[model samples]
Target: MSTESNSRGNHSAENGSSVHHVVQIDASFLSEVEGKMEELPRLLNRSAGRDSCCIFRVPQSLSEINERAYQPHIVSIGPFHHGEPQFQMIQEHKWRFLSDLLLRAESKRVVLKDFFEAVAPMEEPIRKSYSETLEFDGQDLIRMMVLDGCFIIELFCKVGRIVPADLDDPLFTMAWVLPFLMRDLLRLENQIPYFVLQKLFDLSVGSGNDDPSLAKLALGFFNYMVQRPLHVLVKYYEKKGVHLLDLFLMSYIPDCEEEVRRPSRFLHLIQCAKKLNQAGVRFKPRKTHSILDIKFKNGVLEIPVLTMDDFWSSLFLNFVAFEQCYRHSTKYVTTYATLMGCLINTPADAGFLRDHKIIENYFGTDKEVARFFNNVGKDVVFDIHRSYLSKVFEEVNEYYQNDWHVRWAGFRHKYFDTPWSFMSAVAATVLLLLTMIQAFYAVFAYQNPPKNH
Candidate 1:
């Protein structure tokens, strides 16, 4: 009866019902067998905790007996992009890191003298990748600084200056994505603007780095691009509203040579919730999954990462796949595709209307923007001389006629013309009318008053 009760108790514990059990063991058996423990196996086996008994299968024998056992409690944490040992802390650190970099990059110096001094640090940090085995050539940095078109190129050729690096050691290696975003910030005049992004990708594919340091950097950099577009291309035709996302849904790049018609990098981004109100907002990863859930509940970010499903229903098909291709290596494309496919197959919000609202407006309306410039001073407003804006718009229209926006606009035109297409709608209508009339006459003619012929 005791054995039965203990067994029932174990079962109850296993079911999580919270039960208690008491077992009576022979004390003399333990004392007598204490010295010769090998002989005390029977007595030791049945002694255990509050709810169950510890059964010992006879040593070296597969004894199949039905006995209840208490299971050890287990908790699991989700995988993260990098050192997201804890999601909440990681998130806070991410922004803190960004603000620090921004101050160094943009706010540190304003006057021409300070700007020149800042360039000294920019030439190259005294030490690059102090924490990891990363080696950054000083010249390599000039390439990054001159990311914007005319400004960077002209500055490199004309100014020909050097800079000292500020950050000596980073707690974690910044992800490679961070470089692309910084380059984007340089105003998109990079000689090989997307080259950094591609190189990071290559690293992810085969660099065999266990940490994915460069990959994480790339993610952070792109996040910055979401907020600050490379101004040089901001006004360009094919480039307007284009993002760090190098590929489009219908874009022709493949994650791997063996892959075919795969998803683009843009889709995975939406699925990631990296963007807030369409602007890339910064976030840090969590150490544990539950913490991420709690943070999500509190609405730390403009949009919570967990809310990805809510937005998935609204993504454009090709765009969603585009993002998946970047989110992982080509080897995982099929798997990513399967998961996204499930979402695609389910009922979702249709998010395909190409938003023509200019990127500037999306940031804030003209009134607010005007106020920002006015506060900056009259010179700041005059800096973009109408001539400059006009020239930029004209050049972009001419050079990038086939850019994403331009192409999308052309497609919109084709779509809008459907009603007015003479050969399509009008001709089809005429043909339909003629067919109907003939059918009516044929049916009536058969009954033609048996004319009297």
Candidate 2:
């Protein structure tokens, strides 16, 4: 019995020993954890310095809807897409552009070393301009900035006619290539900081009293996107922007004071074009510089004519993605996109807008245009009450919800939607009135024989 008890005690001791060994942590593992913990403050500091970051990689949620909209097919501008395999062909052109810029700069006594020296001091701030930590080393980043910046400035100069474009230049010779390049340049990821471009432009081109600013040159280069009046471009040329994309976006924003209004309790989407038309809401093409300047008055909704093409689609998608990702950016483009999505639900709605001349659909069919808006507005989140178009939305919805308006509109649409239908209704009313008059006279004649004589 004593031996059996001793055996049980030994087994219990062995179990306890096993549990202790399992619970024990290695000294090396603790040291490694401590090392990682030490990195936390450095990581925090690095993140904190990224407040100036305006350029971003489009979020996966937004990009997955349409990857081509955010990606550059012709050229890679910044570190986000640098060294991409598809962008290799454009790299040769970039070097050629750089050579041209250098030749032009030589007359002004500026050299390659001057550009490198100018950008080297700005490497840290330039790196921080991007949302993500760039993997390029100091030298590589500086080289990219000089090379890319020079290419863009030179391209802008040639396109803006500040300098003559090479007669044999494929970018100019090929009709399709310049449009693609313009689209690529405006991409959110395909941008360097505006300051970098400014410095490079000033160095290479040497700004003069008569020489247009880089902003002007850029606007001129991208003018085909909107074809706004020269005065409009001149007005926005002096406005400061973080980058080229921001500059282009700023041009579209209306120069109106923000209205002081209480936030709406709940957000609402206005009805599509077809429903609105059915409800007697008239759509007129607004004559305004800003596309966001949509107005509602009485029973009419006036909207600026929007040209929908592949370039505009890509431009708007990136604009919306930027507004969504960047906190400091105003949600003008996103709000416009959401409003467009609400107003175009199907091919019929698109067709209605097309008929009204509110939407110039260069995109395939009405169905494709509808799909474009739907895809753009997918998964987007914004505060409708604070939107620039909030009042427009509220007024439009209120007008649509009125029972009297709907009934009257329904009556008019059912009866007088066409000129022939309106004429028929008028004739029928006259005929009914004449018959009533004849019946009254007949009743009088029957009641009094003398009156008949």
Q: Give the Cα RMSD of candidate 1.
A: 25.6
What TM-score does each of the candidates earn?
A: 0.18, 0.90
Cα lDDT of all candidates, in order? 0.29, 0.86
Q: How well does candidate 2 score on lDDT at residue 15?
A: 80
lDDT of 1 by residue, 1-453 (tens): 588998998899999998875656798877877767655233232222211211111211111110111110111011101222333443343344333333434442333333233333533221221112213355444332222222222112111112223343232245642332233222211112233333322322223444232223333333332332344222221321122323211122222232232232222212222112122222333332111111221222221122222111112222222222222312222232222222122121112111211111332333333232222121111111121122222222233333554454454445443576635656777899999999999989887856555
- Candidate that scores best on lDDT: 2
- Candidate with top TM-score is 2
Deviation of model 1 at 49, angstroms: 72
Give the runs in model 1 whose Cα sits over 4 Å from its true position: 1-181, 184-215, 226-253, 258-418, 422-453
